[model samples]
Target: MTTITSAQAYLVDIDVETVRTDAVQAFLKQETVFVSITTSDGLTGVGYSYTIGTGGRSVLQMLRDHLVPRLEGQDSSKIEAIWMDLFASTRATTVGAITSLALAAVDTALWDLKCQRAAAPLWKVAGGFRRDVPLYDTEGGWLHLSQDELVSGAIASRDAGWGGAKLKVGKASHREDLERLLAVREAVGDRFDIMVDANQSMTAAEAIRRAHSFEPVDLFWFEEPLPATDISGHERLARATTIPIAVGESMYSIAQFREYLERGAASIIQVDAARVGGITPWIKVAHLAESFNVAVCPHFLMELHVSLVAAVPNGRYVEHIPQLRSITRNEMAIKDGHALAPDTPGLGIEWDPDAIDDRRVA
Candidate 1:
């Protein structure tokens, strides 16, 4: 055992107001959880687990009542083994929701510890394949924004030098979706790379229909049009439309990504390091995508995604959503529409306990 002497989870509150070209919304007002591991040798690492809203409380319960107890006296170096044990321990409890979220937090903390001990950036710990990645502003796609607002966000991202842009689709009707896309095209011009996220809001047939509607503008691809589990459906839709497909945030494991890739399901893979069992599995997915000549563009966790995307030669673009700065004292590194990797130690994040504590629920 590597001798981890202490562990604790904090329920940090997040309240960030995001003002985009479109409508403004408070990205989070709920609690976000962070797990900190301290080694007997005086090493420490911190990692976060978040639920978009109120569900963070349940993840907090799992960490406090269940996961934390298991970490006592274990060596922090055995991150892979620890993650597997926790996943298996919560098998019955986490077919979905809070349990899996808690597992992600602890797993990430262990990786943070490993990288810190090695004195390298995450991409170096994982293996540095690239240093900078093209980025796309993901702000244009939220459901709450108006069409003009969505178009405005797309234009702003383009003006900022982003290589691509993505907007939300599946807005109750194809007519509305077409209108938004057209508005964006007019705002940013027809030649720019544009993408759309259905957010798993459509059926396979609906995805195909909506994709065809934007065929003229040469969209980057349609993201998560159908649910993540429906490989056959995604395959069917791929054959039906010339538009390519993008997926991954909805997927939690490399096994699931392999299933999608093996079937030629998505031309673009969008993995989230925090969501898919931390940096380990996410790196594995990047390698898998490489063998297929596919593009690996990750979803959120932009603070962390910058490193992985920059480390992969075949990486596509990092999703840029600037909502976390209000909660964290430091901003994510982005310039010229590219997200820069952190030169700081660990994951380059220091928890703002006071800022985070301010937003906690009663």
Candidate 2:
């Protein structure tokens, strides 16, 4: 059995080209916490977790001071057991960002180590549903863009052969949001899907009213219109609107997803690997959503999600947001309208060691 010898963590800050804004906040930067684990057998595995613009230091410290020490001498192949140990050891920080994000770095690295040991790519090793999943563009549709910019962006996405485009909603005037959606719909025509994300900015009643107004444009999914805690609000909104209600990015616990799924509050499960703990729990959430016949279109880290989404039968779409370009060798490939799962062994991510070293913040 390969025994873990050491684990290390660091942080990198990736600057966004255009400041990404939505209803709640501006995504000024992406802070990724990278973790690498080495075993006695001389095998090394790397993994990472992210925050929008903060908390990278906290994730790094949690990994170094608390979680990494526990991994010493453990069997690297036992990913689930290791993940559970991390989950249990960090009980005080469980069901929140710091613990979950820290666990993600360790758990994902273990999975990578396991896959590398097997000499198989992550998609096939994970489950191998399909190599290609349809793509939806959110990069071009930030809420800060003008209506013309939004329409042009939708047109560009359609021209580039993406299946859908997501527009940020929750403007002060529902009329302004409606105008932008209508413009995009008119530009992209009836065939291409148009998804809308409100980023949990509205109350239940406002969300219901806005959902009804958006029906005329034929939205693909209504994402995070109400706060994640407002299960009853989401249920009310889901019942009032024909459009599917998608949720889960901000949710830090799997039990939170269960509440929404069992209650029919969220029709599309947008489980983010880092936020949900790691690939281990991420897959559990995917299967949980699958059992409910809900679509799993995960939130971020599309580099990793491409493989995870392709592994599960019910995974519907991969959000096309390339966040790790500055420190990674390959951007995930998109052909026709779908993102292709990488055939590279061990999580399909090739970190440029020098690039990562240059940007190290911790």
Candidate 3:
């Protein structure tokens, strides 16, 4: 029986090269928290979680003060049990970002250990549904970009063989948003997919109004138009428009996703592995979405999400928001409009220890 011998947590702050502005907020930096676990068999696994520009220290504290201590001497293979126990120990913070993020760091490390022990890549070990998932570029679609820049970026993504590009909506005027969408549509032509995300900046009535205006452009999906908590608003918007409502990135638990799925509020499930806890619960959420006949196009952290997307049958697209390049040794593999899952075992991320150490803040 391999037992966890040690568990440690660290924090790093990585800056975004380009300004990333959406409707709701500006992403200043990635406050990444990492957990490293060593087992009695001498196998070590690393897992990580992140916040856009805040809360990394809190997540790190949660790990150091509560979660990591409980991990020592536990059976390394009992990932679910460990996850539940840690979660229950932090019951006051359950179903929230801090607890979930801390659990993600530890839970993902356990998954890394599980994958290494089996001698298989995470995608294959997790489900083996597909090796490559279609790619969509959000890097070029930020709301801060000029209309011409947006058009050029869409065309550029198409030229590079990416399947789709997402545009940030929720501009000052509905007409302005429509104009930009129309311009990109006119430039990229009819075959390419174009998506729009409001970043949860609109109300139910406003979202329905904007969805009506956006219908002529043939958008692939409308993402996070209303706050994630507004399930009834999303339900009404979903019924009011032909465009599919996509959400789940802001969500923190499986039960939250179930509410959206059962109410027919979300058509595409964008489950972020870090935000939803870790690969354990992330996979559960994916299977749950599959049962509802919904496709998953998870939010950011492309390095991790690519494998998760490839591991599930219903994973439709991997959003391309390259945020990990500075701290990782390799870029995600992209070919012919798709992101390929790494064939290597143990989470599939080639983390640069030296770079991580240089950026360590905790």
The TM-score measured for candidate 1 stands at 0.91
lDDT of 3 by residue, 66-146 (tens): 999999999989998999999999999888999999999998999999999999999999999999999999999999999
TM-score result, candidate 2: 0.99
lDDT, candidate 2, 329-348, per-residue tens: 98898999899999988999
TM-score-best of 1 and 3: 3
Each prediction's TM-score versus the true structure? 0.91, 0.99, 0.99
Model 3 — which ten-residue stretch has the worst lDDT?
Answer: 300-309
Those runs of model 1 whose alpha carbons end farther than 4 Å from true positions after fitting are 19-30, 360-362
The lDDT of each candidate is 0.79, 0.91, 0.95
Pairs with steric clashes in candidate 2: none
Model 2 alpha-carbon miss at residue 171, Å: 1.0
Clashing pairs in 3: none
- The runs of at least 3 residues in candidate 3 whose Cα sits more than 4 Å from the true structure, single-residue gaps closed, are none
Q: After aligning candidate 3 to the native by TM-score, how far in Å is the CA of 151 from where it should be? A: 0.5
Model 3 CA lDDT for position 295: 97
All models, RMSD in angstroms: 2.7, 0.9, 0.7
lDDT against true structure, model 1? 0.79
